[model samples]
Target: MEKPNSSNALVCELINKGTREWNINNLNSWFLPEDREAILGIPLSSSNTPDRLVWAETRSGKFTVKSAYALALEEKVHNTRADCSDESAGKIWKTIWQLRIPQKIKHFASKAARDILATKSNLAKRKITPNGMCDLYVVKMRKQSVICYGAVIMPKKFGRIAGSGVVIRDDAGEVFAALSKKWKSPLGAIEAEAKALEAGVNFAREVGIREAEFESDSVVICNALQGLVSPPSSVVNVLAGIMNEVSYFRQWKFAHVKRQGNVPAHLLAQHAKNVEDFVAWRADCPSLIEHACMQDKM
Candidate 1:
């Protein structure tokens, strides 16, 4: 076969060495004069022998004439054979290792490999459980920075998914408003909840709603809003901007609610995920109710 590129010159040397270290008389024919010059730095001569070239060394610290390709091929064949064998080869390899390596280290290294494999396999799938303890949260938004929000949380289980909520008030504490939003995925939950809150506040502002009650099932979201938790990860910059813009809406409160009581928010989340094809107010959600009735019949 033709020699490999200059980058793979070592492999070429190995191949040539395997071919009985071609002698100058006949070997010169195997190589172009330029290649010979490149490898040996001179034209081949009648006196040049296999031994001279076979043991030559290069400036790059490589064996210029070693049978590297032949050896590599043999090594590949041996490894393939060993890998194909089962318990017999494994035991043999283990016995060889026992003779060569420290017993304590061998077991430790083997266990580490097994642990890596287990982790890799387990990562193939993720489990999602939606227990009723936590409720889903959703919100509607028009031009608010904090846009469509959603989350699921169990309020009674965790005191503060993130802290105390904000308090919005009118001239007196008696006339005030409170709002909070919660969700399932902690990272994305707060952003969605915040967006929902911003939308609600904006809507309230448009309608001149100065004093009202707004609550979210996401305690973590409330904590974030009240500066109880650290800044959220997913939508920090956006939520921060929303918070800054809502500074004028000081008459707003953030409160936590149990999942059971946050059905409206949960429905909104389902709506956000395209669970409901149409957005409208119906006493029984006839479309959903009808879909459920059909599923039961099936």
Candidate 2:
């Protein structure tokens, strides 16, 4: 940098005049031996075009605070896990606490895990309701399990790629399994919905869930499944495939839900953008949809 005009010079200026090679003379003139060696050791691009900075964390070369925070949190988790070999076995607690739900929910889960929840026994010792059950819990009771699915396009309005999310939970609102997946170049929105259902059925079968309610947020797809509306041309093949799988279920039903009611599945669909073929969890839900799952149950 002390050499005249070296401080402001671009790297392209140091390229050899007639070849795709480093200018040894210019490097020697402007840089110390170590610096010159490092420069020479750096791989040169085949293209001679001017270089530009790119953010590796995003699909686009743009940076966002959300991505940065996620990266930081991931690094923290990795480092913490690396530092405490024994605690690696305690990730179940980490999963419970890191749930994206409200603090009260987290507190309740922690208490339940410790047998300190205000259950009937605990409440009998106190002055609260004898059952110690909230309306949310009471209302969630069901006779059978249900697998709900949702779909989303990456860019929402115009993108061709899509995400498919599936969540399976019993009538008691206990999650059994979850799946998040990315699909490439779907024909359209309805097709994407069919794809999500397809993935859900496949996941359900793979996980040995023989019979359950099938739910989705796409009205068109659900109506088609129920034969209330004719299946559209774009979704006919995919929807048929879903039925072929649904046939294996001893009992099954198709259900439609609005966007808000399908938060867990919807968020899981959105989360699909971050995974490759898919992400799955058994007897556990992904932290990415923790808050959404709570919201859905509520």
Candidate 3:
């Protein structure tokens, strides 16, 4: 009989002690019942042979790199359960891949949505210093005339405020749409600026302007949108909502200009102060803002 090796040392000791003949009662102390049964089931061979390791995965009892890799993958899959069964996560990824935007933008947006991108907040959480800057690579296309929208708010007395303006114009300095409205409550200038931006973007969407640019004179609001500075905690949610709206655009950008360039919107906002309710004009320039719009175009 072949001598048992280190793997079966207890059995080898018994075999060396002239106890080669085995029975369940003799083997019970040294072997598990199932192991003993397996040993007993093997047919004894008349020819002597050396004991060798056998790989049960293959009929030839030899290991292959391919089989080892497969086994490792199986073990890994069995251990990682959280990511295996997530249905919505896969769907969201597929949707992002199918969007018509640039691949780089899609990639950035997807990472941002998952909160996994290297944003300042995420870096701070990992105990790393944030760069405090955002680098966006904008692809400049032919400078086609784009529809522009602007907004402004005015304050009044007795803790009551009125006047908000929205102006939309084409590249030729023609105002296609203009709005003036009065509000019942007072709002801070920054809050009013943000509200105006939201309203203007919504109006552009409503009017079927898929590709457009929006300009605001408020440097603070513009900087926040470009990721240059963090908005106050009070307005973070508002900024997030505006960003969500921006995602709907196929091509869009926000610009910060001198107050001189934003005169039309400013003038309309001032015009709102005297209005009782709301007024809007379409397909024609408002007499009040025509010169202001022309100056901006110049």
Candidate 4:
């Protein structure tokens, strides 16, 4: 007769061992004391010299028995139950899965994990880091005479585009969309961007909206928004005022996008720059920005 495979033999050996309160301590040594007790209960001490002990650790900073051996003991318990019939053996086997479910959930950085494991052997040379940056495309343009900035919004549904936005606030709160006017100089760009964010946040807040994500291509505005440095005199006080108004939001994230992607906002702003009097909305959009919206529909 052919020899039995090691896995099958091991299963059979475990079945023969049976559950007479087997050494759970060794199987759970890796888990914390509370987790160990939660899963395995207290160990059954024995006076006999032959009784064996072993232990292991768990992620929650506790010690428990080695998991595989505990699984072996659980398998033995179900196998030796007399009332469990031969035809019901598969059902009994499924019970072993219950013990392993929790242990299977741990996540790790895979490429880095492989690199570290490779160092323990003589097989490979490359050390890999599995982290990458979020690619940002910023499009900036003139609508009428206004300079606008924009970045794409990722949609909840996959493979789709949501609306985009111009960064109105840097450190104030969540990102929002708004209408802005054209500025001829660098100082103009900074003040205009800050005002746009303040306008957008106030509009959103009036409607009870909270939390937002904002992005911009202007490094000057971005750095100022983050409070990494001061904005020029024309913009600082307004930026600070906007921050106070937006302080109720849960969080705000500022991102920098490249200029090529900020086109839509640029178009809106360019249109707004020429208007004599600004109304926050025209047919649900700022009247100054209506031309840009109409052009987009076309």
What TM-score does each of the candidates earn?
0.31, 0.49, 0.47, 0.34
TM-score of 2: 0.49
RMSD of each: 26.1, 24.5, 31.1, 25.2
Per residue, candidate 3 scores C-alpha lDDT tens digits across 1-45 of 643432344644533233222343544444443344334323221
Whole-model Cα lDDT per candidate?
A: 0.37, 0.63, 0.54, 0.38
Instruction: Give the candidate number with the greatest TM-score.
Output: 2
Q: Tens-digit lDDT track for model 1 on 1-298?
A: 8544332334334333432222333324344443332233121111112322221122222353344564466457545654626788688657756676444345444434333211212212110112223333422221111111233222334421211122233333221222233221222234445545544554445445554555555676667767887543333434454455455564556566554433323434343333221233212323432342233224
**Clashing residue pairs for model 3:** none
Candidate 3, superposed: residue stretches over 4 Å from native: 1-155
For residue 291, what is the lDDT in candidate 1? Answer: 44
3 or 4: which has the higher TM-score?
3
TM-score of 1: 0.31
Q: Per-residue lDDT for 1-298 in model 4, tens only?
A: 6433221233223121433232334433333333322222221111111322222222221234565565466446534553335657556544644444333121112222223222212111211111232213322322111223432222223211112233232232222335443222112233345555554555556545466555556676668778887554444445555666667777655555566544446645444434332323322444444465455434
lDDT-best of 2 and 4 = 2
How many clashes would you count in candidate 3? Answer: 0
* Candidate 1 residue spans exceeding 4 A from truth: 1-187, 273-298
